[model samples]
Target: MRSRSRTYSLTFSIYSLILFNSLALHASEYLISYRYVVKDSALYNESLSISQAMKKCSGSPQIALELQTDGNKNLKKIISQNSEKFTEYIHKLGMHVEYKDTTNKAMNKSTTIMTLQTTCFTVDFNDNFAKIAPLK
Candidate 1:
């Protein structure tokens, strides 16, 4: 009985660790102000005031104006395909590179972590804020 109890406790502890790590990872999926820079593009460091940012991103005249945003994607794919553009854009702007939420579907492991800089841009960082405003 003693041996069986110890084994059970060990199994429980392992499961608990897995659950905790999973929760931690999922909680990291959202961001408040995510920067998506295009280094090689001519718009680097153009300083689109929020108004200009919104205006340049506008799609249809009916929509008034909109800002461009990119949805979450696999880390490997993003790095492979957009590595050049992303790196160049940030360098040109004298800013950091664009990053993605660690828990994004594209991000597989829980160990990968990233932070959201709330003051950098305007966006709610509440838990469900991403759902409130669709990623462009």
Candidate 2:
């Protein structure tokens, strides 16, 4: 009876490991990087100037807000609901935004990395955004 119980326990552990491995294999990582570029050289210079002034006054660099999600459907929902609002806000700053989406099939879970890139200044609030700092 003891031998039978040990066999059962081993079988259960093997099954659990297989299930976890399968789930991990099916998971994906998603990255949606948004590049915010000033429409023209004049606007780029103005943005740089404003960023410098703000940083001087606040004693900290400006930081752009970021959105994060765990699944494609949720990300789509968020963008659909807020695209216009985001566009208008960025437009007001004399900039245009572009998005680049990438997926990694080897990851163990769903994840999204969103980044905002600009020119001539830096405003980073997270590690992911730090990867694409503005050009100096």
Candidate 2 lDDT, 46-105, residue by residue in tens: 211112212111122233435332333343354445566544544444544343343468
Q: Report how far off residue 115 is in candidate 1 (Å).
A: 22
TM-score of each: 0.25, 0.27
Model 1, span 3-89: residue lDDT tens: 999999999999999988866544423322334443333233322111102111212111111222245333323333554654443
Query: Model 1, poorest ten-residue lDDT window?
Result: 58-67
| TM accuracy, model 2 | 0.27
Clashing pairs in 2: none
Please state the error at residue 48 of candidate 2 in Å. 34
